[model samples]
Target: RRYEQRIAAAARRAADRWAGYARTGDQIDLGAEMRHFALDTIWRALTGHPLDQATERELDRIATVVAALPQLPDGEQAGAAVAEDLARIDAVAHAAIAAARRHEDGPDGPGVLRVLLDAAELHPEYTERLIRDELVTLLVAGHETTATTLTWLYLLLDREPGARRWALDAGPEGSPERREAVQALVSETLRLYPSAWILPRHALTEDTLAGHRVEAGTDLLVCPYLTHRDPALWPDPERFDPARFGPGGSRPAHLGGYLPFGLGARACLGTQFALRESVAVLELLLPAFTVRFLDRPAGAVYSITVRPDGPTPVVLAAAV
Candidate 1:
């Protein structure tokens, strides 16, 4: 309960910050703002403190490292390419861990770091380095997925304007119907642009898949992006149709047919958190403001994650 309250409070702070920009008609980078919002939420959960601008700036290196991973050579070469950014990220992580070790809770409360620190007292394995790794892992996983999903959701809305109206008209503000409608918007957006589009798995033993034989130790990439768009799985696959997730909407019955967050036991841990935060922000912003893009991205970037290939500059206006 306490944790939930802290997350909600962090989200409220993010919404309030965005509302200030929207009210003044400020031009903002939609993707960047979403990143900030997500980082804030996760930081609070990890440290019980709202994310500071300095830390946020330092953490930008995470994105750089992630973008460069696909093309960089393995081992030393890859390490050399991102060595500086990795150092910055490491410095931030160490600092946060040290602070958490001081046993000083943030304004919200003790965070996951504090819990880890407490465990370190009894468990010798929870070394400072391990704690830093956990912190960085949470930071990366917590923000990037949600940020990309929210950015794509807005972009999709820009292309399909009627969908926004359809969602808003579902019911009054804060109503379950409206929330469900907004969630459907998110679901459809994810179908088109799942952040973690690819999942790789290694075969443990020889097996047959779809009448094809697979040898043990073989590597395979399970691409949710491709599966979500398969013509056999989705009718008019390229179409941006939120109705596909709404009531009375027709969809494939197979679990493998639509897995924006992967499938089975190893699915994303932040699925519920991501959906809740996305809907919370949209619930406020959708009814109160409409975004007009000054310029849109050229296309999608296929890398560690699928993302808009360019900047998402936009101006915010009060909803009419």
Candidate 2:
């Protein structure tokens, strides 16, 4: 409960930041702002403190490293290519861990880092290096996925303006109907452009999958983007229809047919958190302002995650 409260508070802060920018008529990079919002939310969860601008700037390297991952050579070559960015990320991680060790709590209070630190007292394996690794892992996984998802959602809304109206008209603000409608917007967006579009798995033993034989140690890539768009599973699969997720709307019943966050035990741990934060921000932004994209990306860049290939510059105005 306490953890959830902290997350909500952080999300509110991010939303407030956006609201301020909207009121001032500030031109904003929607994708960058979304990234900031996600990082701020997760940073608070990990450290019991809101993300500082300096730290946020340092962490920007995460995107660069993620973008470069696909093209980089394997093993030592890859590590060498990203060594500078890794150093910057490591410096930030070590500093945060050291600070958490020195201070029992941050401004908001003790956070997940404190919990890990507490465990270190009894578990010799939770070394400082391991703690840093965990912290960085959470930062990378938690922020990038949510940021990309939100960015894609906005881009989708820009293309399909009626979908925004559909959600706002579902019910009054804060109403269940409205929330569900907004969630459907996100769901449909995920259907089209799942952030972690591909899930890689290795077979441990000989097996059969969908009439195909797989040998032990075989590598497999499960692509949700492709599955979500399969016409056999989704009617008019290429269309952007949030109603597919609305009450009584038609959608495939098969679990494998639509998996934006993967499936089964290995599903994304931050699924609920991502949904909550995305919906919370939309609750405030969607009803209050209309975003006009100054320039839209030509296409997507598929790498560690599928993301807009270019900047998402936008201007905002108050909603009538």
Candidate 3:
């Protein structure tokens, strides 16, 4: 219910902004636009505020910090990397907690923060600090992965006219058929260019992944990009064919090979959320514009998350 209200509000804001750009015929940054969409949605859904001026600046700064860190370093210094992120998470959570406390009198549960605050009342052990940790995790994971996916999706669709046309032909956001098409597009994009290209795991005990024997404590790096592109599973892997995911195309028997979101209990909690968010934004954008990518020799840069090294420029002409 909260998510729906927040999304509806954000959609209104997006439509207004989109209208302004349409009138001016001005080039808009879709990446930045989607970033704002995610933040605004969170603001409305989680915080009960529609992102005040100060909060917007802080969100932008947070995005920058995450982008700068790339990914947490593994090995001996892993502790330090975690500590750094924890500090950032702490700051964001405290800000949110303080804001929620000021407005605790409201009805409708007062958004996600208030929900946590309320939970703390019932569960005596649920402390404010614990609430902060969870909120920090939710915000970072919710924002970064979805934003990266949306940016990459825009870049890929901008390069492929056929995919863009198919997406545009899919009905509006509320249409079930349209939602399925959007999901296929998102799935195919993740297969080709996953936001978290590499997912790391440790062998709890002696085991084997595929044919490789894993000893206890062995660090296992599962490369989704490599596996998703493997000719054994995906034919003509280089091609941008959303049809590859349609009922007809082949899929690997070992679906585990492609891990955009990790597998088992450790997998991303926001997997469903990210998919929904990406599809929603794509459904909105695809019907409105004829997207064309500006020429650039860009490829993925390995970080904590994979992202385009520079701006993925595109021209969004009106689909008239």
Candidate 4:
């Protein structure tokens, strides 16, 4: 709730850029556009400023490193592969930290970076390096996940166009019913495409697992994708139905039934914020413009996060 104003501001900027597309008759890559909007939103929350293209271009190395992580050779080769990218990421992070230390406040206000800087004053433990790590983590976690989820939401709406009409028809703009419907759209998209498809966990002691045995200190992977799509847990699991997240909808009752943001304490802290940001953007865009897909992705690529395998070229037009 504290971040609502910044989220709305960010969404307005993105909506303006999108409106330009509708006005100019230019094609755009929807995936990239979503990424930009998300990056801008989180960047504002983190540093109280919009994401400039120059900084965003350098920070894009974060995605590059993430994608290359699974393919890198073992040991030192892995570090070598992403060394340049890491340096680039570090430069941006340190710059932000320095700015925060200087008490820089963006147009919105002082962001979380300012808070972290203040904490450092009272505690010696909050070192510069630690601050940098926190910023970068916020960037990767908040930016990539929300961006990808939104891209998937738009793609899903492209396929299930009726869902759009259903949502818009549910209630008037700015109404609670309309907001719920919009959130339902984001929820269903997340069910189909969780930010972190595979969450890594480890066993503290030996235990039985689904009628199988587990060894102490064993590494485990919890796959929310498979769990969310289990036909037993979700009837018609593969279907893109936003109503599933609506009131009286048949969402599973058990704790493990739905874990888009993971479960327990380790669950994403920004879950609510992400939903708010998504809804904010959708509220402004959904009723204003209709995206016409000029180039749809043929498949999905599952790396650090699952995303459209190819570019998503789209043209924006005034909603009829």
Instruction: Find the candidate with the highest TM-score and give its number.
Output: 4
lDDT of 2 at 108: 84
| Candidate 3, 154-235: lDDT as tens digits | 7777677678767556665578867777788888888888878888888889997769888999998878888889888878
- Pairs clashing in candidate 3? 70-304, 71-304
Using lDDT as the measure, the top candidate is: 4
Q: Higher-TM-score candidate among 1 and 4?
A: 4
TM-scores across all candidates?
0.94, 0.94, 0.84, 0.96
Winner of 1 and 4 under lDDT: 4
- lDDT by residue (1-320, candidate 4, tens digit) is 77888999889999999989999989998878998998889999999988888899998787778777566646796778589789989999998888877878888889999999989999999998898888898998998889889989999999999999988988998999999999999999999999788888899999999999999999999999999999999999999999998878889899898888999979998999999999999999999999999888898888768788988999999887
Q: List runs of model 4 lying over 4 Å from the truth.
A: 73-81
Question: Which residue runs of candidate 3 sit more than 4 Å off their true CA positions?
Answer: 70-92, 102-109, 170-174, 292-297
Clashing pairs for predicted structure model 2, backbone only: none
The superposed Cα distance between candidate 1 and the true structure at residue 80, in angstroms, equals: 4.1
Q: Which of 2 and 4 is the better model by lDDT?
A: 4
Instruction: Rank all candidate structures by their lDDT, best first, as comma-separated numbers.
Output: 4, 2, 1, 3
User: Model 2 over residues 1-320: C-alpha lDDT tens digits?
Assistant: 55677667766776677678778988899999899988988898899888888999999999889888667656896678589889999999998888898984678898888888999999999998899989999899999999999899999999899999999999999899999999999999999999999999989999999899999999999999999999999989989999999999998888888898888888998888888878877887798888999999999998879999999999888789
Query: Local error of candidate 4 at 130, Å?
Result: 1.0
Ranking by TM-score: 4, 2, 1, 3
Candidate 3 to truth, TM: 0.84
